[model samples]
Target: MQQMITLITNSISKDLPATLEKSLKKEISSLGPVIARAITPIIEKCSASAVADSIQKVVGDRVVNQLDKSVSAKLEATVARQIQMQFHTSVKQTLQDALRASLEAFLVPAFEQSCKTMFEQVDSAFQKGMSEHTVAIQQQVEATHTPLAQTLKDTISSASSITQNLTAELLDGHRKLLALLASGNAKAHSTNVLQPNNVPVTGPPEVEAPLDPMKELGRLISERKFDEAFTMALQRSDVSIVSWLCSQVDLRALCSMVPVPLNQGVLLALLQQLAVDIATDTPRKIQWMTDVAMAINPTDPVIAMHVKPIFEQVYNALLHLRSLPTTSPSDSTSIRLFMHVINSVLLSYK
Candidate 1:
């Protein structure tokens, strides 16, 4: 413990002079200002000019022989002041401008180059770091993916097997059900036909009973029930009904049985379907239109009331058909049928 204390004491002793010297320097720096302040007024009173004049007068007789016996003290002082003033304004300004220009020229390019190099280094480092990070992330993803891919494959395979088994079972059941129905299950397939009275009666179900919706519609029309037939036809959306309805009823007879609005509704439905059929089979539709228009006697006032609206509807459909550009054979045939409809209506009016 004594040796350690002695060693510490030696170290402190070695550093004490440096510490004292620093403190002495600090003290001297602090005193320098006070001393300067004390001497400033005295020094100012004995200015350079005063000092020079005093020295000159003191040494004037002595240096008279050495300094050029022709040069006076006053003349020397004036020359010195003039040189100082010129150097202060002119020389110093020129040197300052030259030095600034030189420094700017030297530093600007170096500064720009240094900045560019630094930026390039930073960008390169950033890119390298990003690339390394990306590589690490990709490696990590690859490491994690094998198990995930296997899990997904297993799950998908299991789901596919389950779905296929279920679908096959459903399809087999459906086929068996259909076959049993075709064989005429007594419980499922009832032997009954609904009559006009809507009473279900047991009868031999007719094989290949025509599934024609228009047949019911024709029966409705023949009964002079235009509204029911029209609703059924519109619900069916069957184009064949347009031709069948046209053939079954004389246009005037249909109008005579139904009210004007009901008659117009039926006519419009027929015309709309006729327009569709004309787009597909123009010649047949045109013939159908002509036959229907002929059934109208335009001169009869009662028929005229019904026939005028049918003509107008046909005219509108014709106008729409004509508006379609005749760019295809179908389009051209449709236009011809439209013209035939217009001509047929005009002839009925005549």
Candidate 2:
């Protein structure tokens, strides 16, 4: 019985634990179904939320960083380009302003004053000297008139040789007067002296004026009073005044000193006036125009305006002359020759 009890006791111990374990497993299995049903969705929800937060942080940081870098780079590049452009513009403007100021300060006024002084001095001296010389010549001529006439009559009565000699003497005196007048020494009392009807005075007479306007103009040009000289030339209406101005000026030299484009208008006007003089049948005028045209840029509008018409006129005149017979030269031939020379000279320019 005791041995049977021991075996039963040992078997009971093993069987009892096994049985309890089985019961426990069955109860846990039942509870697992409930737990799975209830807690599975909650756990999934929590895990999903955590994952979404992590992704949001990562993507937000990456996007934000990229945008910041792009914005910063673009702003920096824009600012640098703008600064460079502004700096370049400012430098160019400053340089132009400085150059303009320098020109205004030095050149214009000095030239004007020098011309005024030169004109005044020359005009005064020429008039004073001319007047004194005129008075002296008049007095000498009057004193010798009666005696000279009587001697001439007496000589003519005696011999044919004496009359011829007396005539020659009178002719020599007349020639002297013409010389004085041609030299601009004789008083231009009337514009009529230029006419064939008016007799000229033949004596050393002092002119009343102190200055010769022509000489004054020449002096101004030589001294480089270009602006003033040009102004004076334009103001004077006298053909002689214009002629003198054209004669004195060195057109090439004047053009060289003058700046282009800026002074082109003034220079062109001067050229136009010169062309008028040339067409007036003055060879010196033609020569002056040729010199001026050569000195200026060919593309210059003023030069083109002045020269193109002259070229056409001369070319047409030549064609007309060619059609005529080759006979003794007339005034028309002279005109044709002058035009031909003008055409040749103008073509040589530039």
Candidate 3:
């Protein structure tokens, strides 16, 4: 039976293609039935029980072998044709499609998951690169901005300092001018006489006249007549002379005279001069002015009369100086002297 099977396989191999070729290529439809009939004899040779088994074994083996060979030949021919057409067409696309379909079937959800993971990885890398680029740009901007900000701050600081210094100088100039005006007014308005105490009774041909009011005050101070000197200094409303005398006199003794009702105009004039002077000569003069101004009874008509005019004069002077486009050297010097006087008076009060 094995021999018969082998023989039938070989015969079928040889005749089947011939029958199919005749039917398919030559247009001979009768060859298929003829081939079927030829195989029937081999089927009959086996016994009824053995026929089915024998025919099944033999025909199955022959059919399987033929199918495999035909499929393999067709595949080879298709591959050869594809290789030839590959240069003319996009073969990679075809291969990719075929691979994708096959992998999809075999890998199922795992394949889909792998594709998603790959895409995420690529996206993450792109985002990381963009973030790094952004950071670099920001750092560059900060590098430029930091210096610019610092430069602007420095410029503002310098400008502010200049403004402050100029304002101070202008204020000082105004006070000096006002004090000079006040001094001139005082000299014109005052009826006080100038007397010298330390002069010699007899003099040479070239002998100078007696010391002026300022010199006499100095002599009195040197002689330790501080009270008399201070009183004498206050008598003359010369802001410059009075200011100098106050500086030389003992402040403790000077303060004791504050409560006494003297000429308030003279006192206020003295204070105004001191205010201007202290602002320049000594910064602490403002405090002194505050103290002395406070010490004076605000209700006193005399104090008010004196304070009001001086305050108005000083205020007007400051406004005038501030409004002026330019200041002269003489005006500048006068302002300095006034400031010195104001400083000394205020210091005495403090």
Candidate 4:
């Protein structure tokens, strides 16, 4: 025992503590991981058991056992009241702020609609007033002009009677003139051209056209060489050529002859071609027209019916000329020419 004590004391007094501390420091660095590894399972086991026990106490029926759940109902009611109060005031306040930020979204359109309705009402009233005013003005205008309109209507009505009376008087004078021409004629005309069976009338001695030219004219009329016949007749310097031709030839059969059926308009134009202005005795005008009218028979009621419009036009032209203060020689000649043609050729069937 004494020897063991002495050896321990020497070992302690020797490099045992310092060498042990150095070896322990060197190994402690490596041994720390080993110690942690060894104690980790034990520490983890202890912590898990403690936490499980704590969880079981809290989450299990421990609170009921510990406090008999006396405050749970009050705490739940407190929490619900707090949450409801927060939702009612705080959430509603936030929603109100959001709605206020977007206030113009609905309000602007509503304001525009209200304005539009007001404008439409005003416009309708304005248009209604204008329509009523226009009607009033129209009524006034119509009332003011009614008398003038009636007077104008009456004047127009009387104008027609005046025109008809004038026309009838003019026609009566014309018939008298024609009768005078027939009665007072100084020349003997062949009735063969007008009245085929009438006996010859003895009047003033007349210079007769040559028999050959008259026979040639008859041949041309029979042959239907109308244009050639008319050219020959109009080309003759003597106005008596037309009277002679009408007196000798069947002019209706001559002028109406064409390869194709001509319109009455063409026949009218052809008849008017016979009106050539030649300087001749004024008395011969009525005589030539008389001879032509006898052939065409314009004085006949049936022929006159067809030639009424033509006579009216000729009559109107003459009246218009008379209305003029003075007339050119050409205008007077044209009027006379038109009168001659109407009295003779246009009244013919051709």
Candidate 5:
């Protein structure tokens, strides 16, 4: 059977091409119309309603869905932006209120108190400084006032005497002028002169006496004749002449009266005199010490150490006086404290 099947396949394969060719020719001749007929109804149906209507429905639905999505997205974005802006505004307002409350509750009161304290401290310091200056000024004024008062009293007395002298001189001159008018000068100078009272006089003018030396000195000083007045005072034998002159003259002017590079001999003589005075007047020892202190112009201990000339001079004078045979050990001990007090004041300036 396998042999018979192989033989039949060979025979059919040999005849297949011829038969197939003939059949294709016949079918091909009728195939065009048949294909046209089969496809025409489907093309017509698609063109008439199915394809265009379905396409329109699908495109419209897609467009409507896309528009809805776009509108929804825009609305959502606007709402979100409004929400964000509202949230920021609300938070900003809240923070501002909190900051204002915190500052009012905490910082403002503390700052005001701090300012008040600073102002009070400044005011107190100013007052204290002013009070100290006022006290110092008052002390200086008191120290100088006695001499100034004496000078003023002397000036008033001198003025009264001058006025009396001038009155006597004027009356004498009037008598001489009347006598001249009565004798020879009246007609000669009458055209140039006016006589309001037209009263006659007969007495001759009297010569004026020379002024007192003290009065002359006072007048010279008042006239600013400082050098002449100072020389005059120095020449006077009066023990209180210097004190009287000091009442009228400035301390600087008095100091100027001493020759420059001050005469050490004169200074020593003055010191010796002061020492004698202080020794004799035991009650005024402290006052002498104060005068010495004023002359030294004391400074801090460090500065005093560097510039010790004046202090040394004062110390040597004190030492020399204390070493005198008249000074007892008890007196030396008591006087030693004055030096110590001066030294302490110098150190305190540091």
Candidate 6:
């Protein structure tokens, strides 16, 4: 039976393709129109709806999602920028506030204290300097001021008289020498005071030779040999000569021509002499002395050292002037300082 079935399957497998193909072509051709008519509208309707659903799902959902994503990103960026701006502003404001607070807390108080301290120091110093000066001057000037001024006047008059006598004597000697030369006697100019018999005269002759130390000083000063004149003036122990030297030597010349340290000594010595109440040269002395004081070099230890001594003498005279009712001006710091530098220049020459 299996052999019969195998034989039959082989025969059918050979015939099946030819017969089935013809019939299948015929059936498909006949059913194609029927299937098209029946299912085409339904398929077309379902396809249209499917395409609409697909478009809505794909395009609309994707657009909404993209818009949402973009909006979120932009919002995030704007928020970040705002936060950054706020943060920066906060930091800057904090720094400024801190600086202001620090200044108010520390720097302002320190500056104010420093200013107050400085002003207080200045006030105290000014008072101290003035008071000490007053006491010292009061102690030093025991004698009446009138006598000193009167004595200065007398001394000046005496000096003038001596200068005149010396000058007259010089002129007379010149005249005598001229007369002798004209008279053909050449020996008249000689230092010897002898008679025609060549013997020494018994008594003092008409015009004695002048021996003025003051005159020698004038010569040195006039010759610009300041150092020598300065030395000679300082070395002389005589009060009158020192006074003479003090009255004569210009402080300006002393400062300009002489070397520093030496000039300092000369200046201090002159100031000392002026302190002795020589009212004769007050007007001349005050102006330049004030200028010298104003121009004082802070770095000069010698000049700085000499200030107290210089002021002692100057204020001595100033205090005396104050005591005199007629010449007393209002109490002024400048006036006190000015009147302290005392005396006149040497004008013994003419």
Give TM-scores for every candidate, taking all chains together and pairing residue i with residue i.
0.28, 0.26, 0.28, 0.30, 0.31, 0.30
Cα deviation in Å at residue 297, candidate 4? 23
**Model number with the top lDDT:** 1
Model 4 ranges off by over 4 Å: 1-104, 188-350
Query: For candidate 3, lDDT tens digit of each residue in 61-124?
Result: 8888999999999999999898878934777778788899988778877878889999999999
Model 1: C-alpha RMSD to truth? 35.7
lDDT of each: 0.57, 0.55, 0.54, 0.52, 0.53, 0.55
Query: What TM-score does candidate 3 reach?
Result: 0.28
Rate residue 77 of model 3 by lDDT: 96
Q: Which residue segments of model 1 deviate by more than 4 Å? A: 1-104, 187-350
**Model 6: per-residue Cα lDDT over 237-272, one tens digit each:** 344665565467665655654344234334444444
Whole-structure CA lDDT of model 5: 0.53
TM-score of model 4 relative to the true fold?
Answer: 0.30
lDDT string for model 4 (124-242, tens) is: 99999999999999999899889988987786666545545554544343333233333434322311111111223345332233456667667777886554454345333344666
What is the clash count for each candidate, in the order shown? 0, 25, 11, 0, 0, 5
Say which prediction, candidate 1 or candidate 6, comes out ahead on lDDT.
1
- lDDT: which is higher, 5 or 6? 6
**Residue pair clashes in candidate 5:** none
Worst 10 residues of 6 by lDDT: 341-350
TM-score for model 5?
Answer: 0.31
TM-score of 6: 0.30
The order by descending lDDT is 1, 6, 2, 3, 5, 4
lDDT by residue for model 2 over 1-350, one digit each (tens)?
99999999998898988988999999999999899999989999998998888887878788888999999999999999998888789976887888888767876578778888898998898889888888888888878887988886765455445334433433333233223333443233211121111334444332322267677677768787765565455434344565667666666556555363214333433444444323244445545545554454545533344445434443443344334343225534544565655566557654
